[model samples]
Target: MEAVEEVAAPQVRQCPECGTEVTVHVRYVSWCAACDWNVDPGAPDPDRGRLAQVRRRLARRYGEQLAEEVARGGSAAGRVGADRSTVLAFGLALLVHGVTAGLFLAAAVLIIGGWHTGIQPVLGGLLLVAVAVLLPRPGRLPQGAPLLYRADAPGLFGLVDEVGAAVGTAGVHAVVVDASANAGVRTYGFRGRRVMFLGLGLWEILTPQERVALLGHELGHFANGDVRSSFVTHGALRTLGAWHSFLVPASRGNLMDWLLNTLLFLPRWAVYGLIHVLDGLTMRASQRAEYLADAGAARAGSAGAAVALLDRLLISEGVEAHLRRESVTAARAGGGSGGREAREAAERELWERLAARIGSVPESEYERLRRVSARRGHSVDDTHPPTHLRRRCLASADPRPARVVCDGPRARSIAAELAPARAALARQVIRDHAG
Candidate 1:
């Protein structure tokens, strides 16, 4: 008997909604990264969507340029001029604070010396009061901060330590697990010890390799010294904001009050403008630092894994939105009888759907996502680069073999270890949602 001939998958020319190349798997329904367009192979094409088509075309062109840049050995590596930028940002932060301090000291000296008598003394006193009110209070750790329960996952902590060592940092001081769809490392305490917060929602969706990539990216921020400069600049900006808030008069009062407010207004406005400028500068530095951290992630894992982690993050955002909608719908239907349990069940269902969707994402589609994400620029205040730009940077970097091992068994063990903390956090989230 003749062997049955194997059929090749059909080639997808363009997305019915958006004109992006659907590269592989034309037979199956696929998602377009450019416009979130879903292509149904068996369904009839709807009306021609010109706007999405135009956008996709522009995105493809831009992506090609970025790819060419990567090929030409562009400076996608995080190390290029990162140290200089960090140093400059830190120095500027110090200089701004130093100048403010000098002014305060000079004002104090004048006030104490009794250089101005009579009304001058009264004005000086008012000035001192204003300054004191405007001064920024030292930041304190939140009373119940380190919000998530400390993970009992020794394997997870060991993985973190491996990544930390790879990045040349001592290691995180603590590891906390939460139920939210996020992961980050923060500096805490007077000593500025690093604390890693791992979100179970994010963890549940990621593959073992992607988990390493996420951890590496967060730890990379500390390894690259992003937190220190960020803290200083952010503190300075907050102080300026406090000054602006206090100096602005809430209402017109007596003639003397009005006069004093008028006198303070210009300086306060100047401070506000300075804050905007400084914040913009620091934001740029922060964006650069993010790219550096992405590079560090690439170093800790493979370039492919780093990029895949970003893609999963974007996918997870969509999943979260869907989960929230489901929660609201379920709550409305059941009159919120089961509360947390119902929500948890819905969450589980949503996660299963998310996992299936992630598993079905094609390589070509992920690449398209990288390109499209790069085309969209962030606002001035945003600290991170666009996801596509981050992916592009990672793609340009040399692929590194991951040092830590996180196979299926290991991943399961880690999850099991954190089960208690995850359950507690999940309950908290459900309660918060119900309320």
Candidate 2:
């Protein structure tokens, strides 16, 4: 089996655009020694749902506008202060909470009336159900979620705390590990405590300093006054999203079901509209939060490391693709009965294979990804601005020394702590992705 074809090149061809002799790396469409061609593999996930489509459209719209403004101006990290959206978001949140309170009150009144009149308290029960449906989902760790506490991973937690201090933010309350090629932070629990999620896939690929930068970025994400991260408005958004999801049917059903669905169409659409409006109202502010986080990354990890971290993000898709290919290869190697053994073998070598693939990314490929990033609306996700823009913001900023350092010994200690997780994640990727 070929090990990540993009990592190794043995083919050379003339450029279709310039007729210049070029080495054709399987990573991208084609490469020319003298000219750029259609290197852009636009929008990786195209077949998204209607709601997702709306979110992506809005993301690109806002991201492009912001990127354009930044290109003309100096930095993308412009401070957003007391923006209209923040006020509106807070008001909307209050309104949502008010509605919930009213429903509960109505339920109470009906229940009392039923007790006096000896009536069936059906309406009260129904109102209570509605209140339950509309309640906000507090961020909680999913059952069986992989956890890395300070006790189990003190060095990692210490590094994160240092980065948090450097970025001028409070330390996280919890750390969760997953297999995704991304990292993020969010508030959890009743008191809105914070948790930092680190994806081992991304973590393994990053340099020690880059990890510090990632932590800095995540730690600073909400501290820079992102209203979306505010637990108050967060409840509103979550409740509305839940309402929409609960009302919207995945498909049409039987006659009576269809009739009820038709009756609910307007209410369902209203909830959806609210969700969209909420997203639109806060998207620019959310993106601003991201740029601010990038600024904090530079502050905590040094400008160079922060910029390199963004550059590393450009190739994350490639890493995912490599995983998919490796999984398929592993599954197929066993054919029928031997698939399990083959997958186990693949699992054992997963980290090494991934490390080599990431290490082998050519400079030209990074440039291509960067260019593609610039051409597309700057976004790694709906809320994130583009990788190119983030990179530019970091690179163009005034240089600064790292506020926290991850020396060799500490790096080794952190790695040792993550060993079990890494091993489990390797099996997870193969098991989940193999076809």
Candidate 3:
């Protein structure tokens, strides 16, 4: 009997049910083995000049993105603020407070032992603890990651890819929608590179063009690493600041002890004031980061888009609805059914109120624009800067299409503009790293 020719186990057209790749005879039904992700392998219909423009932009900008490379060392792990670092800072602060306490206790012992000299040292140590506890500790820093999307329209994602490539950074990894109706980056995790919370309010309220621009703005954050740095900074401060509450009272008690526990209890108001100052600084830093990210997005061939997104976001009720919906959804997900329902009802009421306001638009050009916008499924209420102000800024900037080219000169200019920020961040990185 002739041995039957062995066939290679009837090689399937799809990947092994456990692998990530596969041999596909047709492009339409490719499947992944790793996680059961069946994908359409057919080439995407050609994007009418969009991908080409992105390629051109990337080609034009790649060389000038040297500054991004410099920033990579600090942001490389794609993790923003290290929670361990934060914990350490808090621990050190605690140790300092402990030492201060020990010194005071020793002073008391000495006082009882008739040795007066230790009293001043004890008071000084107590003062040091007071300062440590009263000063605002640093907060978590921001980390940047490539924007990734599983739910956005392909067109939108394609545009984001273009912008990301042009800006000379890794592409985005997640879609971060800040349901807070606030146009800002929302961060979590030690390496703040988790999600790009694009406010759903922006999506529910802006024109397609405006939505595109808002996405461009977020891409701006990715390119700049502002998101990551911001997270790290905030985390660092918060961690340190938390130690203050623990130390302030103990130090106060020590002072009271020195005064025979009768001089006066220093109100906790001073500690509160310190925290406020720290929060203000963090806010200011965040604002600056926003501006820079906006600028970067504008440079990525979508100044008008960014402008439109900002404008619509400022005046869209859809943003409010989106926020309310997210809150309800989150509440429900967290098992708070009754609370979620109440919030959803409240959101519906707010939407009705906003509709009434828009209905008041007189029969004029603004009304026509409103109708056109409605037809386009766009909203005007957003969470960031006001529309009028954003429009004015874009107008004053006079950003032309030609300027969007990430050419050598443009890159150099961007790098130069970012140098100071980068330097400051480098210092921070060093400090954090050393710590």
Q: What would the TM-score be for candidate 2 when compared with the true structure?
A: 0.87
Flag the better candidate by lDDT, 1 or 2.
2
- Candidate 1 per-residue lDDT, tens place, 1-435, comes to 011223366566676776887655642346666676652223442434774344334434443444354456665333424445456656766766776676677677667777656555666667677567545454333443224333555677788888878776767767766656788877676677667877766876788888888888888888765533456766666667777787787575889888888899899888767765565445445555676677667667667778888887765655565445544654664466675566566544544444554576566655554444444431112455556666666776667787665788888887677666655654455445655
TM-scores of the models, in the order given:
0.70, 0.87, 0.40
lDDT of 3 by residue, 1-435 (tens): 011212232235535556544544331234453444443333543454754444333322321231232233222212223344334434444554455466556655545564457666566656556545543333333354223254433433455566666655554445543233545444444454435555433343444445445655666666554422444344434544564455454344565556642322343454454444444333322333344555555666467766654544434544444334434443444355575554444334432333343333223323333333333222222112223433444545656562233345544443343333333432332223223
Pick the TM-score winner: 2
For model 1, give the 10-residue run with minimal summed lDDT.
1-10
Could you give me the TM-score of model 1 versus the true structure?
Answer: 0.70
Which 10-residue span in candidate 2 carries the lowest summed lDDT? 1-10
Tens-digit lDDT string for candidate 2 (1-435): 333444455478877788877666675566653566666645564667988887887777776677666656634456656677778878888887888889899999889878666553678888889899887767887555578778989888899888888987788878889878889888777888888898877887888999998998898885576877777777888888878787886465788788878888999999878887877788878888888888889888899989888888878877788888888888788576776677677887787778778877777778777777776654677878766767876787679999999989999999899888888888788878984
lDDT of 3 at 148: 29
- Candidate 1 C-alpha error for residue 388, in Å: 1.6
Ranking by lDDT: 2, 1, 3
